[model samples]
Structures are given as structure tokens and as C-alpha cells.
Target: MTTRFLRSSSVLIGLAVCGILPQLHAQSSPPTEWVDPDTGHRVVQLSTEPGSESLYFNLNPFTPDGRKMVITSPDGISLVDLATRSVEKIVSGRPHIIMVGRKTGQIYYVDSKTENGATSRLVCSIDPATKAVREILKLERGQSVSTVNADETLLGGTFTERTDWDTNSYFEGGPNRRTEARTADQQRDSKGQLMVERLDKHYPMGLFFHNIATGETKSVNRGTDWLGHLQFSPTDPDLLMFCHEGPWHKVDRIWTIRSDGSDLKLIHKRTMIMEIAGHEFWSADGKSIWYDLQTPRGEDFWVAGYEVSSGVRTQYHLQRDEWSVHFNVSPGLTFFSGDGGDAKMVARAENGKWLYLFRPELLADRSDGNLDTKGLIRTGVFHAEKLVNMGKHNYALEPNAMFSPDMKWLIFRSNMSGATQAYAVELEKGDAK
Candidate 1:
């Protein structure tokens, strides 16, 4: 059971009593409540587990049926059934190892446990309702699956030897040294410094893909020293996406290749005008790509999309005053949300941190774009609130929050009651109030 305790408004009230400020005199932490400005109605919370949390911000983590959401917690990989308001535990696995089948609605995960006293990792698919496990691919000791195709027939994994390294050798927030440590193919300088190796130009470290039906696996041969952030488009069985996996300005960040390992195309190439762009994702229809772009050192923030077939680039520039490194579009492209505070999601210029949602129509809006200064989010909801455990403020939940399949709720992770839990804020109908 969650350790219940008395709600404390005394701390903020004491500040007011000390003549610090009168504004927080009545400002105890409010419950999850936000009224729709359009209808004057309020949303409701769904998930209740104390330590519950959902998938990464970029990954949707929703099953095909839309009735359940995959969540990982101290317990295991579980499902939040929106219809019944119940959580069903599926299997025990590490967070970020779970996947929802795009076509079959099956749950897939990397099963790493001991069998007959021998430990191994297996890429397995499951029937969430029946808890039936089917092993599709067996991984090497260091290999881990990161992405699967729309049909779940093609999958990709990354293998590296630098799992143990002083990752912050270069800059404060540079990418981890996920590349292999072997220097067999590298030439040392006169000073005995290792030359920079570009794996995308030549694949040495294994960036491999496996075909489940044919039992064939091969290295696609297009990656950097470290490859990560793999994603398969829901509309194309042959289309797969991967990243160079490092800080911006290092190299081109995103690339798309066919499942058969042909037509390897660069999605976003950094240029002088637009210095860097990454955090790539597929649009709902798979006809285009969605990503965030900014000038060097995190300025000129812009949310951009590129049409895959037409080669069209559309950018909605946010005011230079506001900033966020990561941006995610809703399933229907109705609105997009931006967040900062994580290492990869920092706001280089902002004083504090926030998670803001914006209507698509208001993205480039010069009139009311400054939500932080305007007060109460414009275009849609302005949720500057955070959820975290009470005593341990630093153990704040990553509100990898996103819109539900039907766009009726804003789902996120919170530890407000002392445990990191997944919670949802419902979007009521226009006339509900």
C-alpha cells in the first residue's frame, strides 16, 4: 500500500507568514485538475499505481486496440486498461525493452533471465491476454533489440563493448561511449590519440537486423560509432529509421533504410542555416518525418516535418524566447507538445523548466506564443505543473506524457503521492461542461 501521510500546505504557508510572499498563502499543491477553456469543464485522472510510469516520450507505447497502454514499473511491464481502470501485469522485464505490435497487437519484449541456471537474452513476442511467450530471435550477450518493423517481421539491435566507460569524456552532456573499444581499424596520431572513426561511413561495430520469417540476420552497414533511437514506420513494411546516436553537430543524426537494406536515404542533413536537427519520429500517416530543429547552442527553436515522397519541408518556428529540445506530434497531428529539463530536453535560455502543449494552428503564432509570460497556456493546455515523490524532490517522474489514441486524454508519469505512477488527464467534450 502507498504510505499515506498528511497533506502539507504548512511549508508554503510559513513562507507567507514570514512575509516572504502572499501569493503562495493558499497555493498548496493542487490535485490534477484543469478546466478546458473552451468548455469550462475539467479532466480526470486514470492510473493510480504509486510507482507506475509509461514508455519514453518519443515512443507511443499504445496497443493497436487503444484500450490498453504499456507501462513499466518496479513490478513489471503492465497494461493500463482505460475502459476498466485496472492494471494488468504482463511479464517481468526492464523498462524501455517492451514494444506494442503495430499489426497483430501482440506485446514484444527482450526477455533476459536465467534458463536452467544459464542466463541469456531472447527477443520474445507475447499475447498480452494469454501471457503466451514466443521467442523470435536469440541475442548475443551484448546485443539488445531497439526497433521492430510495422509487421514485426524485421527487427534491429545494437551491439557495443563500451557499456562500461567514463561517458562524459568530451562535454558535460555528450552521448555515451556506446561504441566498441577495439582500435584494430583505426590509425593513431603522432601524439598517440585515436583518430575519430565514423561508423556510418563504414560499419565496424554491429548495427544488425534480423528477419523473423526467414531466420536471416545481417548488419545493415549504415551507422555511426554508436547507433540508437531506432523506429519503424507504421505505414511501410520496408521502411526503418535509426540515428547516429550522439550530441548534435557531430554528424547527420537520422537515416531511413528499407527492410531489405536498400535505398538508404538521409532524412535530415545539417546545414549552415539550420545547424542541427534530431529527435526524429514518423508522422501519423508515415508520409513524412517529424523532428525538432535549432541553431547551434540551442537557439531558433523550430518544429519541422518533412514529406518523405515529396521532399517538402515545413517548419513552425517557436519564439526564440521559449525553448525545448524535444517535440512530439499527436497521432492525428492536431497538436504538438514540447518538454525540457532532461539532458536531451533542456531549454538553453529559459530560467526554469516546463512541459507545454500547443495546438498545431498556434505553433508559429506570433501573437500568443509566449505561454510562460501570458499565463495559463495558449492554443490548448498549459501544464507547468510537475509530479514527483513528496520527500525526494529530485526523484521527479518523467512525464513522458502524450495524447491518447483518441486524443481525449493527456497521459503522463507522476510520483506526486510518493511513488512514480502513470496518470492520465481526460479531455472532456466541448459541451460536457
Candidate 2:
């Protein structure tokens, strides 16, 4: 790949025409396309809109045809043609995006309207091509729609009882809440205290399903544990996964259940004190569930997998510097990618800020001359490769990286250019260092 550093006057003028230079006037414009000095991989900016961000790591942003991806900005939701690198605004509103329909390629989102201090969420889906929208269901206050099922028939989400302290004020407070600025350590401590208080309260929450065709809603399960991170299996419409959200170490986080409120199974049980697992996601084939696992909070790291059918376990060990806030697998399950974290994160890695590609290599068989003595659990190590040097990126804006449909690029969000924007790094063959 040819490296084009944006230092010349001509390049700046070109970027100005593209509407990217004005946003970078306070800071020097980062190269629109360049080869990383630390890693030979090529990186390109995908969205020209300031404050543009890619979808969450677990959410499927690509359409069913895999030719275009849906991205969000302050203006609205837009589509990026993967082949031509062209962007087109599709939905124009401040709607909260759910996920793209797995079968219909419709963009599903929620639009909120507040009336007389009461809020109602309208669940809707739009045809990306024609911009025609169909209102599916209307959710009452405190109700949310998070995931669309594999067949596009059911919408999975959670409903929570409103409380005076439910505004996530622990993390972000109103202007009048604090009179003085707090240091990073003080802020972390305050947030931790709030989390502990909330967890102890055991707030009431419920998991629900909404049928898109009939407009019927059903509550599947109700509990005090904070229900969150709801996701449906990409291949199995009935299989839904959620987490008991809290400080990771304090909760047995990963759980799966059927759509009809049966077979509620915990995916992982902490084996030791401070051991934690979260950030769970389903494999492309929906045969396995993967998550970031730490042996004992912040000490050891692994990308662990659970086979839903056979109840088997697989883990790939990673170094401290390789730990990421999120990890994702390719469509073909060829490899995995990580958006590396900074020093303030759990791993506290000195040189951890980078985009990484990992190839899992299973451990050699250790059963001495016994072919049938293989252990129930599988172990592996990652052959790590640096794809992009993210030393300048602000971890406050997570990189939420994932593989493109063709597996030729890794998409992520970054604030390296002084504004949060979406970017993609080319996964070039024969370019491994």
C-alpha cells in the first residue's frame, strides 16, 4: 500500500474540498490514508462527518448483502458503500440505532418523543434504499429495544423501573451537581461507590420481546439483577443472550435464554475471586459465544469461548498489552481483532494503544500416547500482529473495532484527529512484520 502523509499544501486543499480539513484546523490533519510507521498496515478514514462513530462491537452494522454499512453521526444515520468508499445519508434524525435487519436489510432504530415530561419510544425500521419507514411498535417509558432477531421477526430488549438515581448520574452529573473538578482517581472512586450501591439495591428489570408482525409484546423474565447487553443469536432466532450488569467482578455476568423464558443458563461462573467476564458476543455462525475473560481482575487475560451445543470451553491467552475493550471474530472465523486499551484501563498496559489482529494457535496435545485422553477444555495462544498505531487516540472514545464484511478491513472509532470519527485499517496480506 502506498503511504500518503497529509503534510503538503495540495493534500490539505483536497481534504478541504472533501469537508475534512476544517474540523482539523485546531490540530494538524491526520493522514486520510497512510501506512503506520510502527506497523506496515494501511489505514483510511471512513467517515468525513465530525463526531461520526461506528456501531457497537457486537452490533451488526453491515446490511444483509454485505455491500454497505450503516454508521451514525450527529446529523443522522448514513450508509457507506464498501466497494467505492462513498457515503450517503439514509435516515435523517437523532434516532438511536438498533441493528440492521439480518434478512431484510432494513435499518432498525428507536425515535423518542417527550410530551409533558413523559417519554415514549417509537420502534421503527427503514428501507435503506427507498428511505421508507415502517413503525413497528411503541414502547412506554423506561422500555428499550436493543436487538433484532436473526429472522427479523422478533425484537429483544429490556424494561426497567424508573428510579430517582437512574440517569447514570454516577458517571456523568448535571452542571449543578458538582461545584469543583475531581481528579481521575476521585472520579473513579465516586463511580465505584455508586455502582456498589446500585448493585446492592437489586433494581427490578425485565426482559421482553416484541413481535414485529403482530405488534404483540411479551415479558419473558423479570428479576432484580440489572439486565443488559441483550443480543440474539445471528443464526438462532430464539436464543437470546444477556448480562447481569454491574462492576464486572461482582456479577456472574453472562447468561443465555430462549425467547419463551425457558432454559435460562449461565454461560460462565466465576471460578476465583475477582475473576470476571463480560463484553460477550456471539460467533458469526451462532455456534459459540465469545467474551473477554480475566483470570483474576486485571491480572491475566483471555478471549474465551463457550460452545452452546456441546457445553465445551475454549480459551486463547493474550498478553497484558494485547487486552482490548472489545474483540470480534471474522465472518469465516479465520481470525480475531482487538481495539487495544490504554494504560488507565484494566490491563494498565504501557504500550497497549493499537489496533491488533490475532491468529489463534491451539496448544500441542499433552496426553502422552493416549489419543482418547484429550481434555474437555481447549487452550490456545494468540499470534498477535499490530495493525495500526493508536498512540494518539483518546481511549475515552472507545475504538469498538470489528471486521468488515469482506474481512479486508477492520473498522473502528477514534478521536485521534481531535474529533471522534470512524476509520478502517486494511488487513494486507504478506505485510506481517
Candidate 3:
């Protein structure tokens, strides 16, 4: 089932044709809204609690059988049956013991808790059906978990600390031991042989892969660099995609590497924009990736995509004043969350109130044999303006709205209930908006 979509010339192309100051169409559009089936109401409030500040979802829950949505909560991991709205707790907040696997019909996470500023870590698992708990690893001193990848096989965590020092013994100078510690008075003054204690420790800052079936564990070395996000290739477990502190520089870049710690490659690097600043996702087919790149200005940078195979990239530009639309659409376009395989839907808010939906096929003709910059800007603006007036509809505030493995259901995290909870929407040809 298909519908005719629109394609508008980019603000850039329109200007380039006239050949002026480059007329950069650096603006982006809002998200496309998915209409709620029941009450002509655009929003399907899934959470029962509302107006609760800080009640938000970080990751989109995964569906084991594409029928039930599994998610990690502050307490632990939980599963919600998409068809029935039945939620069963896999594990409660043990704070430092989140579960992190699900191949055997369960949920998993590594729990980390801070007590008086120190962290304790643990890896745990839970049954989706009966809600029973099982401990995988107990928190050892100085270890903290960060995120669990799509494959339960991998887990990311941090091991870090700091040190302090004392100041004295430079001006007075003189004891035999002071000579050994401070050297000559000139040397002491020049080198500042001040009595200082060296505080050194190694910290973990990455995702690790644990073989649940084999009991084998391996770590991804991000060294002393900041590891922002990590994902295993959907097609190959031996391959991985991650974002880290740019090599030799302070900026952040998306990279790919062989899981065995070889053949590391910078899949995409931005020169003008350095810090990634937010979350990113790999395409369902692992052919492309997406993330938001900020400019020197305070506005959120454009959300951009990179094609893994062709070396072609696409970016959606929105004005800093259009932050509402860009933020809303950024996540939807980055990931897929629907039952149908032929077409995908992405929604973003233009002004916090209005939303837009875009279909890739809508601008297929403008591909230019690749994802051209002109095509992206033109199509994005066209969709953003049209979606704003789609009556009243509420898209998921969280960027995730993906489908189960079988594409039989739509799984998304929602805060319509005030508290963020997992919910599902059925997909059909008629449902496309």
C-alpha cells in the first residue's frame, strides 16, 4: 500500500539556481504526527501519572517476540504486553542491579547506584512472564554501569575516580629527606617541588560484551576517551558502531570497528561541529546512522544521517528558532518503529504544539542518485509545514516508535500517563498519515 507524497525544492536549491550568497537552507522541520485511532485525539496517553517532572524514558523498549515491549526503569526492567496494556515487572529498583538481556523471553540491565558519591554496580536478569529475578554479577568496588545495547550480549559501564593533594615544604627547604624530596632551592622554586601526592586510578568508560550462553566476557576499549553511545551492527555481531571523543582532538565523531578490537574506522566525522551532544541510532538494516550536530551557536545542531555503504549522507536543517520541530523529528527519522516494512513514518513538533510526519518515498524521485543536501532540506520543509495543521495529534515525546522483530506491532515509550511507560500502536496501510 502506498500514497502520493510531496517534494518541495530546498531553500538552498532555490537560492543556488539564482547564484547569490549560497543561500544556505540551514533550516529543518518538525516531526510528523501519528494520529491516535480511538478518540480523534492525537495523543494516546499511556502513563497514568501526569505532570510529574523528570518522569522520562531514556531508551526505546525492545520487543522480544515483537509482541511485548521490554524496558529498563529506575527500579529495574519491566515488560508491557503491547496488545493488552498488561505490565509485568521483571525486576524492581535494586538501584545497582539493573537487568540487561532478553533472548530467553526476559529483560536485562546493569544496575549502578551512588551512595555518598561512590558507586556500586551489578548485572542482573529477570523473567518477562513470572517476574522472577536472577543475579548475574554483584557490584565490585569502583565500577558503574551505563547502558545495555540492543544485543543482550553487550553491556557498557564506567569505572572512575579522582585524587587530591597537599601543599608545603618549598620555602623552608633543608632536611636531608627534604633534599631528596625537594632537590636544590632553585630547583624547588623552579620545578615547584611542592609536596604533592599523586592520585592516579584507571576508570572504565565503555560498553562490554558478555557471552550469556558461554559465560565469556570482553570489553570495548574506549581508553580514557568519553564513550557516548555504542551499538552492534544489526547485520554483524563482529562489527560495531559507536561515538567517542574524537581521536587526537576534543570533538566527538561516530566510528565503526571490528568487535575483536581491529579495523577501527571513522564512519563519519564533522569538522565544524564537534560535540555530538545527544543520542544516536543505527538504521534497521545497518546501512546508515544518525545523530544531532550542534553549531557554535546555542541552538541544537541539525540531525544528520550517513549511509554506511555509499558514502552519501543526509542532514535535516531547522532554524534555531525552529528547535521545537528539529528536536521532535530528529529521533523519529533516525529510527524505525512500525509494522509495515515498505514505508516508515517520522514525526516532529515545530513549535512544541504542531507536528509533522515524513515518508522517505515522498521524495524518492529527488534522490539524485544519493541523499543530496538539496533534497533533504526541500523535502523536510515541505513536510514540516503540512504536518503542523493536521488537527490535534500527539507524537511520542521520546524519539523511539519502532516495531517488534516480526513487524506485527509498534512499540514506543510514552508519558501520556504522567509517568513514562511503554505502549504499542497497531500499524496498517490506512494508518499512514
Which one wins on lDDT?
2
Q: Write the per-residue lDDT of candidate 1 for residues 122-152, one digit (tens) a residue.
A: 8888888888888888777446677777888
Residue 103 lDDT, candidate 1, scale 0-100: 82
How much lDDT does each candidate structure score?
Answer: 0.59, 0.83, 0.42
Instruction: Estimate the Cα RMSD of every predicted model relative to the unseen true structure.
Output: 10.6, 5.3, 17.5
Give the per-residue lDDT digits (tens) of candidate 2, residues 62-106.
998888999988868889887766889988767778889999999
lDDT of residue 111 for candidate 2: 77
Candidate 1, superposed: residue stretches over 4 Å from native: 1-45, 93-96, 161-203, 222-224, 320-322, 340-345, 349-352, 362-397, 428-433
Model 3 per-residue lDDT tens digits across residues 1-433:
2212212336435567787424333434222233454422222223222211111223334444556555545454455554454556555654332322334545555555567997755566666666676666654443444444446565544333323212332221111012235433344344322322111112334445555556666665656554444556554556677665322124445777765668777764545543343345566556666655455324443556667776666665544333331232222353222111000111222333323233332233555666556423222322222222212323323324444444433344444433444443433323433
Q: Lowest lDDT 10-mer window, candidate 1? A: 170-179
Ranking by TM-score: 2, 1, 3
TM-score of each prediction: 0.72, 0.87, 0.57
Specify the highest-TM-score model's number.
2
- Candidate 3 overall Cα lDDT vs. reference? 0.42
